[model samples]
Target chain A: MAAAAAERERVPFTFSAAGLDHPHIHSMVQGLLDAGAQLMHIYDENPDQANALRAKFQTGQVVQELSAILHSEVDLVATSIVPSKRGALGVQVLEHDKHFLSAKAPFTTMAQLHAAEDAVRRSGKKWAVFYSERLAVEAALLADGIVQEGLIGELFQLTGSGPHRLQAETRPAWFFDPGKNGGILCDIGSHQIEQLLHYARCKDAKVLHSKVANYAHPQYGDWQDFGDATLVTDTGVSQYFRVDWFTPEGLRVWGDGRTVLHGTNGFVELRKYTDVARSAVGDHLYVVTDEEEIYFPAKGKVGIPYFRQLIDDCVLGTETAMSQEHTFRAAALAIQAQEQAISLTKAGERR
Target chain B: MAAAAAERERVPFTFSAAGLDHPHIHSMVQGLLDAGAQLMHIYDENPDQANALRAKFQTGQVVQELSAILHSEVDLVATSIVPSKRGALGVQVLEHDKHFLSAKAPFTTMAQLHAAEDAVRRSGKKWAVFYSERLAVEAALLADGIVQEGLIGELFQLTGSGPHRLQAETRPAWFFDPGKNGGILCDIGSHQIEQLLHYARCKDAKVLHSKVANYAHPQYGDWQDFGDATLVTDTGVSQYFRVDWFTPEGLRVWGDGRTVLHGTNGFVELRKYTDVARSAVGDHLYVVTDEEEIYFPAKGKVGIPYFRQLIDDCVLGTETAMSQEHTFRAAALAIQAQEQAISLTKAGERR
Candidate 1:
């Protein structure tokens, strides 16, 4: 015990950054660095992206190649690469004897998800997903305790709405390509699916129905701006979620993401991003129970604990941060939802 | 115009109350009375119920037989009878050359709905339904104007949640009988389905999926306490609704019903019954658009106009209050959902 404590004090958990395709890599790195993890190296096809990250933290070497980070002395490698490439990259990281963490929708296709699952089994390395909507949002974290305490009783239904602004001109070419970035369900809907799995505490669920539509963005061929799906677990816990790239420019935030939990006793609603006209601050949790009706503004009060747990999970080969199975299942369900989605655009045309 | 105005002043629209199986008959009578409609007669199988209506209104003679009201000169007949009997009652009233207004879930089954439709066509008399959730609620009334003004843009999605406390002890025996009262979807779920149809501005939609569960009340045998369904209009406008009987005792109101509408430019959310933790005063409408975020507490500001319009429609042989087709379609869709519903209790058993 003394030796373990001495080692902890002697050297901190170290990780390298690879493929800064998504902006989420900044938060993922910052969260780990805040949790006392050392950032060793960074790499991106765009040198400016790697340099920008290095400048932001004033740490980590701007490496020239992906191989350099893959063969590094780091405990884990985190990436926010093009989603279709992420599955192969995760396999490569695991083969090189390091854990892998990727921005969600960890894989764009079912085949990719299958390969990643196989990689985790063969290499015995953790494959964690940065489901920041739940892990990083304070209101969601607060709701976790409320739900687990049986304050609301057994959860029976969940609904999630994620509306994101599409700054169409600013996005990369790959954003509209389904093969590169995945469809709307696989991309943004993954966050909602992950939270449902986490809060319901269930392993398996069946997708009942899913649909996608290109409501207003006809310029981007075959690019859907809206997607929704319904799923139910074996225990009859049902979930419905809608994700859209239709946030108007007049909104104050990037999105107005909300989650609602309906339980046997009462219900809980989380205004994760903003409370609209009421308040600009996020993490607004409104809970109604048998005892009381309460509103908890939990913005700064609850810190993100997932980062520290992930660091420990990487170093000790533990499953505390998130289970390997859950990471794959969430991604797999999203891919299934995307693959099976019926086109609503055709229905719209009939009108 | 002068003669019509003079005639309107001379003779107020008159109606008689027939069935008192549901308590909504009280509000139906009160609204019309307040709107200057004369309550001529009241009849129920239970004399005490008729006497209660007479005592509350200080008008409306308690008639002993249904034939007295049917043969009377009353222009319209409003009834809140047992749901399964309502369609037949409506047909009888129409055959007597009087407009019929029944409490919603106007028919218990598709066959009953078809009978009512035929009666309307044959007699050339109106068969209206009192969808009081939207007709009487002030916030819903307020939302109608806002939506018509195109402030939120073209609506693409709507979600309605209606939760009612199950005071099972106080309810009549027929309340739990699916054959007598219709299933939960055809009963309470009709309110949500009506609102969705009205807001989506579409006549027909497909029920993609539906499910019901006896979550907490198993003693009530096949009496589902929870139900939810997904539907979509031909215009690609999607809707989802969940109705339940799990409102806990601590709530200040009977239920905390809510409705949300997502449009092209923004979204609108209505806290119809109570805004928990905020105020007991209901009719809270929150509007989030491209230009502003605003909240409107519309309890006393908007009056129930459906009563007056319904009275006018009955007297003038006009379709003004609500289209006959819309009323029948709402009930038909709810019945379809109930019939096609998958039993969620079976799925719960697997867990």
Candidate 2:
């Protein structure tokens, strides 16, 4: 009791839920709750969905309209809306002088991103996206710490894999449209892009070349099944990443997601999902430093620190957690890559 | 004694070494010598180089000019010349009614590839390039067998890494020129393209998109320090690969070259060089099948079977080793990727 009394208490921050569409909303909400945020309101067009999530968390009051939370003096808003609705919802959240935290692939088009940024500038509020590949994964958090501590020493390159389950049958109509999902580059590619920016510590990146294809799902005209892009960052770090929806059903996981970081001193590879044809286990990190070799099983052992830092950033009006420019630039690069992607089939065609 | 006598009595195919420049010439020549092919002549413009190579092999008579071997009765010519000179030499080898076996990046540009394809049509002699990632790596050969045995079901995708040492101080002037070395895509990328073709059983591939960069070497006008490409095969398999000259000196070996094949029933990953961040050991294979998990330490156990098969194909007119069309298609894709490459630093500028 004395130990608890002596410890500094975390200042509570109040926030609300916006769109509960993308499945990542659960994790996003869990992160906020875990970080000691007060959930005051829940807003969604569909009452059933909103009430279900509200009942599950049992912290926020269900509201029928989004404006209820927007007008309220909530510290911030948490959302995982469909890509098309994310931008407008973010603008509304910021216009009400509240911070915005949404699921990745934050905007489906450049125009929406521009308007959201404009609103953010006008309101001087925080704009953060849930790059769950890193934000949710404890392994990623551990890696960031290790990297920042100079364990690997001078990271030079990062290659990431983003093989995802399509779950095509259960997806909504907007999921099949290119303009809505923003193509594969802007959609799934955003995860790797965010990681590239963070690990490479680059403020800007140029999409050197990108390719997208609908080899299997031609039924959905422009919905891409596979996407790849290569880029060079302002810090001179090189990156290559491939995202695909062709993960075989028998593979036991959504993907064998891994990131291999090449550094000047040595290399580190994080097996985020399956350990590539080994066990079905995930969060295995292998490090070869100048002093020793370490293999760490990092699953469940680490917690999401980004959420806590972000919570503090929102409450304090500081950009220490992550700058707003990075959020916008990462999104911008993905969208630009999507816009400039070449077709994999005809070889010369563009979407 | 009976088996040894029979092997020694087998009809030996005679060949000449046309280019004594690239270090891969030693491996290419060793493969032939081990496969029971009799080296009849050594041909290079530099007589001293030809003589030195002949003295090392302790076989093959040193010839003054390349024309000496082209006019002789040699059944095949193994060449590993600069990328730009490879195609014209291939044309000469074909026109002379001799089979051609050369190192990868068989052509520097697509036009040369097209002309070589035309020559292959005009002359029925075999044309094979060494794809050593699979051809030399024991783990790859084992994976091929496993996949063929239905251990990992129908293949869907492949991810390959072709990291190589920069060896800047040891490199020649021509090695830094894209016109001579064919940039990173046509150079180290050839191994990946060939693996994609062989493992996917793909006859042809389209260069979907490609990026090349001179991130570290700004003075070398077209020398690429890194390159990546995404391609789709006619058989509906997708591939993404990254090749770079940024293997850190701390790395114990030349590269941690690896290939991961995703199949329907399971997945197989071959650690072709170092097992990466764990041990300096190479040729480690990990596989996850429906029935079991298997790990293979495949070094020194697997031999270069492609060489023996190629010798038979040359002496007896068989292509059990690999198809002529597959070779040309792999080379074509790499050359096409090189031709279509865009510089990552310059963004919109393309080769």
Clashes per candidate (backbone, < 3 Å): 0, 0
> What's the true lDDT of residue A228 in model 2?
81
Please give me the DockQ of candidate 1 compared with the native complex: 0.61
Candidate 2 residue A56 Cα shift, in angstroms, is 3.4
Who wins the lDDT comparison? 1
Highest DockQ: which candidate?
1
Q: What is the C-alpha lDDT of each candidate?
A: 0.87, 0.81
What does candidate 1's lDDT look like per residue over B125-235, in tens digits?
A: 999999999999999988978887888887888888899989899899999888898998999999988888898788988898888888777677788888988888867
- Report the C-alpha displacement of residue A323, candidate 2, in angstroms: 1.9
Clashing pairs in 2: none
| TM-score of each predicted structure versus truth | 0.97, 0.86
DockQ of structure 2: 0.26
